[model samples]
Structure formats: C-alpha cells, structure tokens
Target: MGERMFPLERQKKILELLMIKKVLKLTELTEELNISIDTLRRDLNHLTKQGKIEKIYGGVKLVESKFGESTIADRLISHIEEKERIAKKCSEYIHDGDCIYLDSGSTTFQIAKYIKNKKNLTVITNSVPIVNELMNDDVELIIIGGKVRQNEQSVVAYEYLFNFNELNILKAFIGASGITIEKGISDYNLEEAITRKNMIELSKEVYVAADSTKFDKDVTIGIAPLDKIDYIITDGNIKKDFINKFKKITTSLIISE
Candidate 1:
C-alpha cells in the first residue's frame, strides 16, 4: 500500500520543484507534475507534516528540514524477492496497450512495481497506494471514485460500480487473503471484497497474485467463486496438493521463483 500508491520519485519531484520555484501554485504543480489535485493534496499533506514543505491554500513551498521519512519506505522492502518474481511473471500477460484493473494488497501492488513504466497501458484501480505507484508512469490511469480507507490505503465501494460495465478491461490482477476450492477467493474487508468482485466482473480475464502462504487460508469476506479466476500467479513454493486443486478451477496458472 506504500509506493504502490505514489512512488518516492514523484514525491521528490514536488519537493524539487519547490526548491527551484520556492512557491508553486496548485495549478502549476498539477500541470507540471501530471498528478490529480486530490492525490497532490494527500502528498502535500504528508510533506507538510514531514516538515519538508509548507502547504498554502492553493500551493506549497519547500522548507529546510531534517525529518526522516516514515511509514512507507520500508513497506516496499518486505516479501521482496518473492513479490518481485511473481510480479514479473504475472506481468507477462499485460501487453503494451492493455487496459487492466489492479486490486489492493501489497502483493497486487507488486504487479505495479513491474509495469509502472510500461507505455500506453491503462490501469484502473481504487487503491490509493497503487495510484502512488503509477502516478509518474507513461500510462492512462482511472482511479475509481470512492471513500479512501486509511489503513488499507485504498478506495472502495460507493458509486464506483456505476460505469464499470462500459469499460472493456482486458485483464484484472487481484490480491487474495485466501484462495481455496471451498470458499473461493476472499479478502479481510467486505468493502474491499465487494470492490474486487466488481473488478473481476468488469474484466475479460481475472488473475490472482498471491504468495504461497495464502493458498489454503480463507479470510473473512468472499470475493468470487473459484471458477471466475483465469490464472493464478504465485511463488513456486506452493504445495503440490494445492496446485492440483487450483488446476481444477483456473484455466491457467504460473508459479514463479
């Protein structure tokens, strides 16, 4: 949910601009930064509290400060090798101009880690963290409008499902709290579950990016039935029995090192 929201580089760009311009208007920042107003507001808030910048009503200016960055930096460091491998392998299906949906969860965010630089891709997501990951990329982004959840660092529910039927999503990369032949795919939050369900329904193909630990576990909220999944991309350490079961449900699967 961290850089998977807005990368460290983009945040640095804002600070760099303030260093040069001293005081930059919101319009200038938005225009030059190429990030949405709402997203910039959140970044500015973070920088303000970090004592790196002073937030004015319509703009911000850099401030000399020594506060260390917290909360997000180390997050991208966890499950490092596994997530990176899974992310790279799962990303093979994403073509140059594919329109896709990326779900919330650190694992799915890993998918963004690999494809943020892919040109002409259209990524539709409700995860605030995912937006952070791709904000500076050369791609079209569509953030699903909804209330942002602070802990999860994602947006969900509300009117987000309205025009999904009109979007021709080529593929959906989802994160699962649990994946079993019995309960299907699930997440810990009902709101997130519903949101992921919405994305699965909108896309032509659905792929779950899960680590080995989530294979047999079942969480609180259900996302979709087993058969809805088209591919399962995960670490090769998964149990053979679990892989056998998954084969019966999904059309294809990939186990990456």
Candidate 2:
C-alpha cells in the first residue's frame, strides 16, 4: 500500500533541508523530519513528481527547473535578462573584420542579435539560428556542416569536428551547465560539451557566457577545465565566495550588473 501526502509544513521543512545540505538520503529526511520512513518516501516521491527535486539512489536533491532541460525553448526563457546583459558585454569585444566563433546557445543567440548590423567580420558557427541571424548581413557567415541536434538547434557530429579542424577560428563564446572549483566546467549534454570543447581549442579567446544560476552547480558532462577559460561573463548575483574562487582560476571575470 502507498501513503498519503504530508502537511504543507512538512513539505516546506523538506525544501529547507534540501537548501541547507544540498542532498538528503531517505533515512536522513525521515529522521530529521520525525516522520516514518514510508511517509518520507511518499513525500520524496511527490516532490519528484512535482519536479521540485530529483531522486538519486538513496537520496534526493533540489534540482533547479532551469537546469532541468537543455532545450532551446527552455533556455530561451530561463535567463532572458542575464543573457541580454552578457550579450551586451560581448559586443565590446567585437570589431569590424574580426573573425569570430559563436557557440550555439540561447545566450550566444542574443549575442547574434547585437552583432547583426556589424559589417566585414566572419561569423562561423554550428548554430542554425545564428546562421539565419547573420544571413542578410554583409558579415560572412560560415555554417559548419554536421548532423542537426534539434533540441539545442545546433549541429554536432564527427563530420562537424572534421570541418572545424580545417578552419582557424579567432574567438569563441560558449555556455556551460556549471562552473566549480572541484569539477571545473561542465554541460548537461555530451554532444554540446564536445562541440564547446572543440571551439575552445580552436579559438584564441574563449568566453563562457552563463547566468548567475549556473554558478556552483556541477552537471554530468565535462566541457573544459577552468584554466582554459579566458573570461566568464555572468550576472551579478553569483556569490562573492564563488567569484573569488573563480578568480584563482581565471584572470578575467566579468559580473554584469
């Protein structure tokens, strides 16, 4: 037999514990909440069903819904203002006739918006939308050929890497799932990670464009090591301690207001 849902106070307390400790095992939650193990399980099950948390083996963890999926539509809404701020900052790096590589991302797409009117620069990318964004501009648009990954709205395949190897990209603007002292940079998708990694290697300057929410959260796929990143452009809400920690790894950290 199953169990009934706990009172709202119990649910609030569960969320509190998750925020404080980051993760809680079934037994741990039950003991801390002074509830039966079965009741705790039911609460966890309910929370998971609501998308408030995720079940990981013997434990549960708070998973921000923004990090829940890497779809283009999901990303388009997750950090709209922060992306705009970062995109504005990226424009200062652009100059006429400068060759550039824009990594496929919702944030990078915003960068594309700001760069559309510029002339005499080469824009190379695997992003479908970016190609369309600059197609009418005088700026030369180079679309790297590969299999389309529709969810991210980008291309990535062995063939794409082969094509990427043949070109020398000048600058790269990439995205990340998380930046950490321990785990370095990572992404939610393995294919996106590979594409970002290759872009980083091919470029002279690599800028990671992420929002405040991306800080301190480690996802599964490793994109690149922290030392390899030249700039991290995120919104101002990133914790000072985390930013200070990043200072040890990166020389330039641009926290947009």
Candidate 3:
C-alpha cells in the first residue's frame, strides 16, 4: 500500500501522472499510486470540475489546452507586445546573405516585419502571412509547397519533402504552443510539429521564439527536446524560475526587454 497523502498532494500527483501518460485507466492509476478507488474518484471529480481532465468510460485524459487551437489571427492580437519584443530580439541574430528557415506562427510572422531590411538574405517559410509580409522585400523568398491551412495561415509541408531534405538552413526560428522542461517544445497539430522537427534537424542553429506564457505547458505533439534547441528567446516578463530552469537546458536563454 502506498503511504497516505493529503487530498491536494494526491490530486497534484494525479495531474503529474496524467501529464506524462496523457491517459490512464482507473485500475492502472489506482495500482500505481496504491490509492483507494473512492479516493481516486474524488480526485478525478475535482479535476474534471476544474476543466483540467476529461473522464472517459474507464480512464481519464488531460483536457486539450485552448492555446494550440487558436487561429493565427487570434494569436496575433493576444500577445502583441510580448511577441514583438521576442521577435525583435530574434531578428538580431539574422544577418545579410544568411539562409534562414522561419516556422509558421504569429511570432515568426512578426519576424518578417523586422527582417525586410536585410540584403541578400534568403527567407524560406511555409507561412502565407510571412510570404505576404516578405514577398516585395529585396530578399530571396522561398515558400515551402504544401496544402494551406487557412486557420493557421500556414502550409502543411507534406508535399515538399524532397526540398526539405536538400536544404542547409543556417538558423531556424520556431514557435511553440507550449514549452516545458519535460516536453521541451510541443504543438497541438501533428503536421506542424513534424514540420518544426524537420526544420530543427536541418538547421545549424535552432531558436525557439516564444513568450513567457508558453513556458511550463505541454501539448499533444512534441516538436523537439531541449537538447535540440540552441537558444530560447522570450520577453522579460518571464519568471526568474523559468530563466534558471531553461538556462540549464539550452546554450542561451535570451530575455528580451
């Protein structure tokens, strides 16, 4: 039998376990925690009431967070200032004649506005908004061919696997729906996650540009682990604890003002 724990402690433990496993059968959870069925039920009810978990017929799974489901337009207006700060700081790493991959996201779209002045730069992207932003600029622009996802204003790069294989990206700037020490970086959409993964693998340097709100969250599909990221750029609003935690993972954590 597992040692008895307070209600809050047990509930916290249950949530932690759910975070890792995503879904857990009632018997499995009870056996793993050595808790009574009634106790587990109470915890499950509390979590369900909080909209944190969904109770299935015989198991429970975490509720999908709304951040990942939001459209690009929705995201664009939500964290305008924070996104701009992070994007401005991210743009500092770019230079003339560099081949960079910008993953499709609202933050990366903000990067397009800042990089219009760079000469001889090659910008490759799957974002329709980013393409529109940089099309008339004096830089070479390449769009990854794919099915356009209207909500995201981005391409699902499944049609251009060959092009991705041959490209040598100098630096890749990516955005995430969530970031966690355990999950590294993740997004809700599997196709987007796969696209980001390919970009990370092909790039010499990988930078994740996200606001402080992205930290300590997890989503359905994982893009890459912390070991794969070279830098994390975020706004100054990030907590000191997150700074300390991420410093140990990536080469640099740039906190933008």
Candidate 4:
C-alpha cells in the first residue's frame, strides 16, 4: 500500500474542497478529517501562508475568489488602486501615433482611461467600452465588429477575427484566465481565446495586464505560450517568489507598487 499522507496533505485536501465548492466552515474540515482543533488551526495557517485562502470567523475561503457569485462591480472594487497604478505604468509605454489593440478586462479598461488625452494614436479593439472611451478623442478607433458578450462587455466572434487579420498592430494589451509557466496563457472560454490568439499573432509586442489574483488560477482554454509574451504588468501583492518564477520565463515583468 502507498504511504499515508501527513497533516499537510490533509490540509491540501481541505483546499481542494474549497476550490470546487464555495465556502467551508472549520467544523466541516475538522469533522471530515478527524483532526483536532489545534491541528486544524495549524493546517489553516499553512494554507494561509501559501496564499491559498483567507481565514474567517469559523471557516476559510479562497483568497482570490469571486465570493457568493460576485458581480463585476464587486471585483472592480477589490483592486482599484493597484489597477490604476498599473495603468499609469502602462501609459508610459505608449507613444503618439502607435497602433494598439486593447483587450477586455478590468485592468485594461483602466488603461483606456489613461489614454483619453493621448493624440494621434490608433486603437483597434473588440471591447465595446474601450471603443466608446476613445470615440470622441483625436485618436483613430477601429472597433472590430463581433457578437457581443454582455457580461464581459466585449465582443468575440468570427467578424472580430476578420478585422484583426487585416491589421498590423504595434502592441496588444490583453488579459488571461490564467498565467502559468506550464500552461502559458489560458482563457475560460474558447471563443475568447480565439480572439486573444489572433491579437497576439497580429501585434509586434504583447503585454498581459493582470492583477495579482490572476496569477495561479487555471481556466479552461489555452491561448498562447510564455514564449509569445513580451511583458506582464501586475500588482505589488504578488509574492516575490512567483514574480521571480515568471522572470525566468519572460524577459521583462513589471510589478506595480
């Protein structure tokens, strides 16, 4: 027979349960694992140290979770300052007259806010809000036509691909469902991944704008490999160890303060 697991394995099991479900009370973990209260506390501490979950009054929940099926408004509040800081840093990379593609995500939307005053820039995107943000600006906006995804406030369909195919973009600011050295880049939906992949292929440089929470979570579709990425712009709360891991995978990693 195989060797029995230690307390750490038991704690990992608890986390697995939390990931698949929504929330779990301390009593549930202790009762199911048959562990003492003190041992359970130690397990929770271990997982917390690893940035797996947050400890609550009687239970633990995933640290980077959309709790209680949180709406987009709720998520926008979670990392507002960090995203604005990242937007400022990304703004430094854009120059006058650059042809850029902006992807649909909270962080990238913040970048759109920063680009409003910019002049003579050409923006190509399938994000409805982004197109509207630049509509009255001195810049030229080429909105890729596609079927709209209302929840995401963006479009992802074959017509969008047709728009992308004919254009030569200077840079692409996009997001991923997950970023890992192993899987590279992934998205939760296949249709979204298709549009993202086309943008990556069309752009000379691809910059991924993600908050710290998007670091380890794996979604369902594969978009691109690490070899295709030029930079990653994220927040300060990301552990130094994880940032270093990505540095070894890509050349430049900009982590905002």
Candidate 5:
C-alpha cells in the first residue's frame, strides 16, 4: 500500500474544508479525512496552535488563509470548472463598442475565449495567452509593452504606463491570488500588483472574477480594497459566509451557475 498522507497535508486539507463549509464537525472531518479521532485530534491541535483555525464545540473553523502564488499551469488546472463559470458570468458584462482591460489571469483568459465573437470590442491586456487567443478575433486587442513574466504568461513593466492615460477603458476585469475582507485584492508579485493598481485607476468600472477557493485569503502584495471593485463574479458553490461578506464589499455580487 502507498504511504498515508503527512500531517502537513492533512492539516492543509482541514483548512481547505473549512474554507468550503465554513465550519465542520469533528465527526465529519474524521469521515472525510479517513483518519482516526486521536490522529485528527493531533492535527487539529497543531493547526489551532498555529492560529490557522478556531476550535469550536465539536469541530474547527478556518481563520483566514495565507497562500503562495502558483505557477500559471497550476492555477489553470486546479479549478477549471469554477473558473469557467466565473468567466461566463463576467462575459455577460461585455458589449460591443466598449473598451475593457483583462488582467493576465487564467480566469480572465477564459473570458477572452468566450468573447471572441463580439465585434468592435477593445481588449487591453498584458497576458501573452489572452493576446494569442484574441489577435485574430473581431475585437481590438492591445498588448501592453513590458518584460514578459513567462511563469504567468504575461508582461509587467512601467515603460508603457503613459499608454493607459491616452485610452479610456469602460471596464477592468481583475484577477487576484487571494481576496479577503480586510485585504481587498492582492497577489504574490510586486510588479503585477502595480499593474493592477494602474488598471483600477484607468477604468471607469472594475469587476473582480475569482473562484470560491480564493475567498478569505491574503497574499504577499495588496492591490486595492473593496471600494475599488464595482462587481465580483464567482462560482455559486461558494460558502454562504463568503457570499455575505463579498456582498457587503462590492456594489454587486454575482454568483455564477
């Protein structure tokens, strides 16, 4: 038989479960984890001591999560269905004659794939993948000039910052590594964070599209707070607690089917 999961892996799963259910009883956790009560007790005790969870009457709840940035391939593969749902929901906001900015995110790239047929739509992006998908489409594509950040399949630089001032964008669709009520929007890269802040300033409206997995999490760099977002489109499977929290932060909270 294969080796069993490590304590660290089990603890991570516990935190992820908390993010989904908001709360879980010890019994449910034992069943899901396939571990005995005594072993799970050790894991829970460790996580609680780390300040990662709050031990309630019968189970545990997640404190906010701190996540590291993943490679583009990792991000694209982890939650494909949820990302697609969020993308489809965000795509409904696109219209002909509108100039929009698409952040270089896998989810935002999905939006590009969905909107290929929209004639006269101006798409400004720094993402290599997004540009490759839309260059031959009916939409107007503007690729920002910057050093390519190959891991993200995007570019980041300040040399072309003035270009944004010359154009009027109707909307900006931003993606983030983590989003918390306290942190608003954030990512792991300093340069990417700078670019997102500029996009926020240049656009008349901002829409953030992220999956449920991104909720209640914070990363290394801060982008902006709730006040900057006009709308947030996410998958419907998100926890009710997250839904309520996001609703209070953004002007409109759309749950995608």
Candidate 6:
C-alpha cells in the first residue's frame, strides 16, 4: 500500500484525476487513491465547497469551464446531429444580404456550416472555428479581434465594445453554457459573456442557439435575462416542461425537427 498523503496533496490529486477523467465514481476514486471512503468524502466536500467539482449521483465531476468541461474539439463532436438540426432551423431565419452575428460555440459553428449557401450575407463572429468554416464561402465575414482563448479557439476582449456600435446587425445568434427561465442565458467565460451582451444590445433580433442539454442549468456568468432574447432555438429533444417554460419567457421558442 502507498503511504497516506496529506489532505491538501490528496485533494490536489483528486482534482487532477477529475481534470483528466471529467467524472469518477466514489468507489473508483477511493480505490485509485488508496484512501478510505471517509477521507475521500472529506476531500470531495472540500473541493465542492471551493467550486472545483460538483457531486452527482454515485460520483463527482469537475465544474464546467470554457473548455474545462470539455475541449472545443470534444464539444464539436458531442451532440453533432442535434447541433446540425438546430443549426438548420436557425438558418431558416437568415436572408440574403442580411448582416448577422454568430457567437462563439459548437452550435454556432454548425450554423456557420449551414449558412454557406446564403448570398451576400455578412457574418460577424469571434469564433475561430466559425471563421474557418466560412472563410471560402461567398458571404462577407467579419472577425472580432481580441485575446484568443486557446482551448475554446475564440477571441474576446473589452476593446471591441465600441466596434459593435458601428455595425447594423439584423440578427444575432448567440450560444449558452446554460439556460434557465430565471438566469436566462449564461456562459462560463466573462469575456465571452461581455461580447454576447454587446451583440444582443445592438441586434434587432436576438436568438440563442443551444442544445437540449443546456436547458434548466445555471453557470458561472449570466449574460442577459430571457426577455432580451427574441427566439430560443434548440433541438427537439428538449423536455416539454422546458419548452413550455421558455416559451413563456421569450417571444418564440423554436424546436428543431
């Protein structure tokens, strides 16, 4: 058996393990760390209190972060079909010659894919993935320059706030880390949240594109209340209760087929 570690050392190991595995069962953790259940529980409780991890049924998982929950590559593959459906549904809203804002996220990257056939559309975005997707397309592309977040492959900084005022954005399709009736739409990164809020303020119509899994959840930063959104576009897998709840808050709740 390995020598027992100090509480801080054990806790640090637990967090490191969670950073790799994302989630681990209680028994698995104890066995791997060669610690008692009670000791593991104490460590978990401390981590939970510090907001580094969250306890789930029979296991613990790291708290969500921009790319900490899962890297952008992982997120791009996750719920791919659902994201495609949501993106296709969102594309129906875009018209030729329209200027739109696509926020940085997996779903918005999918939107970039679907809008390639549009004519003379101008896309304003901070997402590197979306920019790559539409780089050769016929549409006009505008990139918001800022600090690049490596894992998320997005740019965000306070310097672009004044730049948004000059453009007339007809529609803005934003992404959310979490969505609830109360908090509305929330994101994990403060810089991203600031960019989204500016886009929402300047656009004539604001649409939030998120997957069903994002519903009824709250995250670290709140972007705007639900009333600020004109439309909520999500996959058809969303619960009826969530659909009903969101419909009451936004002007329209669009469920992709």
Clashing residue pairs in all predictions, respectively, total 8, 0, 0, 0, 0, 0
Candidate 4 stretches with Cα past 4 Å from truth are 1-74, 159-161
Clashing pairs in 2: none
Runs in model 6 deviating more than 4 A are 1-67, 160-162
Q: Compute the lDDT for candidate 6.
A: 0.86
State how far residue 56 of model 2 sits from its true place (Å).
37
Once model 5 is optimally superposed onto the true structure by TM-score, how far is the C-alpha of residue 239 displaced, in angstroms? 1.1
Looking at model 2, report the run of 10 residues with the lowest lDDT sum: 1-10
**Pairs clashing in candidate 5?**
none
Q: Write the per-residue lDDT of candidate 1 for residues 153-257, one digit (tens) a residue.
A: 678767544576777999999988788878788877888888888888888999998888788888778888878988888898889997787566645668996
In TM-score terms, candidate 5 sits at 0.71
How far off is model 5, as Cα RMSD?
12.3
Q: What C-alpha lDDT values do all the predictions have?
A: 0.77, 0.78, 0.85, 0.77, 0.82, 0.86
The segments of candidate 1 whose C-alpha lies over 4 angstroms from its true place after superposition are: 1-77, 160-162
Question: lDDT for model 2, on a 0 to 1 scale?
Answer: 0.78
Q: Write the per-residue lDDT of candidate 2 for residues 1-257, one digit (tens) a residue.
A: 12244456677678656743567888888777778887787777788888878989889888654555756645655668888998888877888877898878878877888887777888888887687667788888887777898757788856534667777777898878788777768988887788788889989998888888887889899888778888888887888898777656653789877
lDDT of 3 by residue, 1-257 (tens): 44478878878778656643567899998998898898889888998999878999899987765754876755665688899989999999999989999988878888998998988899999988787778788989888888889768788887445478788789999999898888799998988887899899999999999998998899888889888999999898888898788656655889888
Q: Lowest summed-lDDT stretch of 10 residues in model 6? A: 65-74
Clashing pairs in 3: none
Q: Candidate 4 lDDT (Cα, whole model)?
A: 0.77
Candidate 2: which stretches are off by over 4 Å? 1-68
- Candidate 5 lDDT over residue span 31-134, tens digit each: 89898899899999999899878888987876643455665644655688899889998989998788999998878878987898787899999887787678
Which 10-residue window of candidate 3 scores lowest in summed lDDT? 13-22
Q: Candidate 2 has what TM-score?
A: 0.70
